[model samples]
Target chain A: MSEFDEGTAVVRRPDEAVDSSVFDTELDKGWQIGGGINGGLLLSLAARSIGEHFAAARGLHPYPVSVSGYYVSASRPGPAELRVETVRAARSHSTGQASLLQADDEGRTLERLRVLAHFGDLARADEDVRTSATPPKLPPVEQCVGTEHAPPEFLASANMLERIDLRLDPAYVGWALGKPSGEGRIQGWFRLADGREPDPLSLLFALDALPPVTFDLGLFGWTPTVELTAHIRALPAPGWLRITHSTRNLAGGYLEEDCEIWDSRDRLVAQSRQLAVVPR
Target chain B: MSEFDEGTAVVRRPDEAVDSSVFDTELDKGWQIGGGINGGLLLSLAARSIGEHFAAARGLHPYPVSVSGYYVSASRPGPAELRVETVRAARSHSTGQASLLQADDEGRTLERLRVLAHFGDLARADEDVRTSATPPKLPPVEQCVGTEHAPPEFLASANMLERIDLRLDPAYVGWALGKPSGEGRIQGWFRLADGREPDPLSLLFALDALPPVTFDLGLFGWTPTVELTAHIRALPAPGWLRITHSTRNLAGGYLEEDCEIWDSRDRLVAQSRQLAVVPR
Candidate 1:
């Protein structure tokens, strides 16, 4: 498999002039295809980009904060424009959204997301914490991914899921991956690696692709994301992204979803959820 | 406190020339307020109403399969108007979005949610059955709702919340009532009074109003929501809405978020998460 170029890791703004040469018909399917970023990957990157914009607007460091959720509606691909809008910026937290539109080879605004972001706001008085359960533990990551038990390798290959290693937590054992890096309910470590250093925003781009395994409960085995969301608990580490998520299957073929993130130290990082369509 | 007249759990829809009295008086605020129900609450009811409509359209039980995250932009409150359009509907799942609008009796569009919904398809898969972990033991209901550990009576007095009770899982053994739901992680039980028939939509309405108890890891506190989302996993059986969530602190005060939901049988019910404004 071709490796992600080491140089592509630098934060590239959507508004920046991108070479149409990077656009490949073959990439219409590549994770970083159109304009060199696949829809899913682009969705994640767009979210991180929005977060970064929010931070830069406020002159906050550690760069962009995090993502709440991301959606990618489609038209034909190419010349798509992603516009970031800062919704609200608070002391402990901030909020922003991005609209990624697919214009026909030229620029026509086909589909978009008002992508959203959030961060820790320290403005209020610390209230009593309601989260108290230790993150459920899980088996080794080796048991799930890279194993015979996993679905077709093509599934993993298609996801191009970067920097995440999941293991079912032995406790609730509910899709627990590993630990995050904060001081709240969530506890996991995360970082993006395309052979470059990952900023807080880049790490999140990688985090938003995985679905809560618990949603698998209703799986006769079809998974399609009608919508996707992420709640970053804390800024992640620099090499790998680890987390645990559980999904609740509703009566019909639909799923209302939720996923929580923890920093590596078992500190509360970010929590998130979404509603999705079960591909029939 | 007066009880919600459980007479007919139906909304006075516009088609029937229903009473528009409650929605009068447009209030300019981040939230749209109706005399009887808030925007969040109305959205839930509307989903149910539309869900049934889809079911009737397809000759099904009008099963609500899922909901895209709830998006609430700023709006003026007055006699509100909602318009719903089906995105795609199939025998398995029906999906659609609705727009909620309000004008000062002048037919101006206040806010729109292209709210998407999915219904009728539910999956039951093994391989991921992690329900072995029982809901942790916690104190009885009375103690939790009446203590200083919770927001004092008035702030907590919203009538819609009266029928629900939440408690900290003793396994985590938290003090100060407990930590609020974190960014992508949340935990707790919620349900209507025992014996009340369970309505997937009603549970959903509650889910929408759910407040993420995210605390500031940097300052340790709670933040307001710019947006909230809910996902349904399984059909609930008139039980408590067990929930868990966490947060990610970001630059310029922004973040990404996620959350999960469950029923009394400890069955995975649904999940939700959102990007919210965590104020400093």
Candidate 2:
């Protein structure tokens, strides 16, 4: 099994004592970045817990169509628990909220991530009627710079890079050479090293897998995400996913970064927007 | 008081047994569109509830910085109840989840909207260091088409227009003459008719106050928003705000529309993205 699959595995906990369901999972170190767990990985764990709750309840909605997560605190590698409560279940869709919690250094259970998700079956989606969205032009994957070869300082904090293959557009990687592009944009091709196929749940991880767009703007420090919302528009076809992340506005110590992902079939599979603090 | 202020007024409900805080508010007819309460108004109510929750608890974070709301069902103009639960209260920011519930025809309490909001003190924000964002080019307010005089069919359902002044860019309002530019974009100037200025709270309503961007694509039918996430980057200046909504991808019976709000000082105040079903 891929490391991602193993890392995000969750087991339902016996929960007759509480109104909501609880699940336990172990956060692994393979997904750590900047001495903290990847935000996407934490989000995926919350998504998995929600999916498990719906499955055990035999709910008709199985796929996460839209989910918004707020990062309450930094997560570390350890045993964590997720508590999910169903908000509502309608004929067409279901909504739930999940909280990923872990024990801090003081042995206090801290809520690290909180997610509100809407689930539905994507197989029932209508066929595409029109699309003006076109894929961004990029050189062949071979010509692009592999993120595994990123600057040594970046690689020091980006331990998650070892689990996947991310090739960035050459034009946007000038920062790696000590000459930043200052474009506030990053485009890349993403795929798992073990050839694991991307699913709706895993797409949450991929949506935020790339380096921060601020890196290209000459601000090479960490830009922690404050809140992120992802929409799964369609299921993906098996292959490399083309991704682009860009920020248009930076003000009052906050910036909004937008991302779009297209599958191998050239279909828009996912879209996400995140609010992050501008690195000081 | 402005109709908007009157419409979204919320009073704390006395609840001694419940675990969450509940507030009662009336959904006024002045904000109805297409026989449904405006999504922005519903979101504003949720934000207000969160703010009230923080204030009542004496939390330091008084302003909502990031909020994501999922529209569960269409809401009608009437009495609605908002129940807010504190997710996590941190030193820098506090998080809360709220559900806006209303009684259905069968007297069942149906969840209409669910929101997760992050609150912080905006006055403590850092000064703007750099920004690549620019306001969209627009004609003077007088030269633009006032949305109150929109196409009769659109006006029929857009009663909210009477409470706010929305002047659309003439180049994008060709749909009113049966000649849409097919550009899938809408830009406008927005402000309350009473000349009331926008604050961080009211900016939530203004984020989604304009007509659907799909209208410029000649899709005149209603486009129901499935989920919307808005980030309050800064407080707006006391003047007309420039707003633009546009869609880049439309597929699988869904589309993602993005909106940017710029204050009169040309500072980006708010940004939002919504997932909506395409009109059939």
Candidate 3:
């Protein structure tokens, strides 16, 4: 199995309460982007737990239609607990909240991340309507620059690069070469290195997998994501997914990054927006 | 005080529990869009409750930096209760959850909307960094078409038109005139009809004040928002706010609308994205 599959896998535990369920997972090494596990991976764990919780209970809504998550604190590699609370399980859709927690040095349960997601059946969803939507234009994976071209120091901590194959459009990565582009845009292709097909759950990771768009504008340092929201538009077919990230406003020490992802079939599969602070 | 000030105003009550505070507000008439109250106005109530909760408890963070909300059920003009829970209180920032509830016919509290928001002091935010960001070019409000031209039928249920002054870019509203633009873009200027100055709280309404972008695609019917997320970039500088709403992806019975709001000074004040289902 791919390292990502193992890393994000969660083991369901007995119910903590009538409306809440608990899941345990190890925050394995090699996913660190800075000093903490990748925000996308943490989100995926939450999504997985929610998916499992609903599958076992209702078996009606299996796909996550929309999810919003807030990063409370940095989580390190260790055993973590994700407590899933069933907020509302309606006939059409279900809404749930998942809080990823870990023990601090003092043995206090620290909240790492909290997420609220809505689940529905995509197969029962309306088909693509005729509209102006189109896949992002990008050079094929072979023509795009791989992480091997990233600064060695950056690649050192971005161990996620080892698990997920990411390729960037040459135009948006001038900062990596010591010359910043100032465009505040990044385009790339992503896929699990071991070839595990992308699914709705993993699309959460893919939506946030790209290097912070600020990197293209020449900013460095950790820009912790304050809040990230993702909408899964459709299920993905196999193969690489094209992604484009752009930032139009950076003010008040905060920046918003918008990402659009399209599957190999040229279908717009997912969209995400994240609020992150610009490094001071 | 303007209707907006009164409409969004929340009166804080004693704590419902230790970590939870309750606020009461009348949904008020003149804000119904389709069959329920405007989503933006409902979100404003949630933001207001969070603001008041933190101010009374810790006076540390007064502005909502980011907020994500799920519309559980439709709410009408009536008395509603917003329960605010302190999620985490940190030195730098705070997170809170607010659930807007209204009693059903059976007297059970029905969850109408729930939101998670991050609060921080915007005054301490970093100065605007140099980047490729600018406001949308819009004709002066006077030259744009106002709600007077909307089909009388739409303007009937859209009493929100009476409360919010919305001026649309003519090119994007052909559908209103029965031409159907098919561009899926809507640009306009927004301000309260009573001339209430815009603030961080009102910006939440401004971010979602315009007609759904799907209207430009010639589709009609209530497109319920499954999820909406907004980021308050900077406090507004009063006057009319230039707003642009666009949708590039509409598939699987759902559409994603992206909105960007700029203050009268052309400063991007807030941005939002919402996922809504296209009418069947």
Among the numbered candidates, top DockQ falls to 2
Report lDDT per candidate.
0.43, 0.87, 0.87
Instruction: Kindly list the per-residue Cα lDDT of model 2 for residues A1-280, writing each as its tens digit.
Output: 8888898999998766333689999999889998689988887888888988887775578888888999988888889999998887778777888999999889988988999998888989888657788888989999898886566777898779888888999989888887778878999899987789999988999988998898888787788889999999899999999999998877778888888899999988998999997877
List chain B TM-scores, each candidate: 0.67, 0.97, 0.96
Model 2's alpha-carbon lDDT is: 0.87
Tens digit of lDDT per residue, candidate 1, span A129-172? 43444553534444433311234432444434443343333333
Error of 3 at B82 (Å): 1.2
CA lDDT of A230 in candidate 3?
92
Q: What is the C-alpha RMSD of each candidate to the true structure, in Å?
A: 9.0, 2.0, 1.6
Cα displacement (Å) at residue A110, model 3 = 1.1
Clashing pairs in 2: none
* Fnat per predicted structure, each in turn: 0.08, 0.77, 0.72
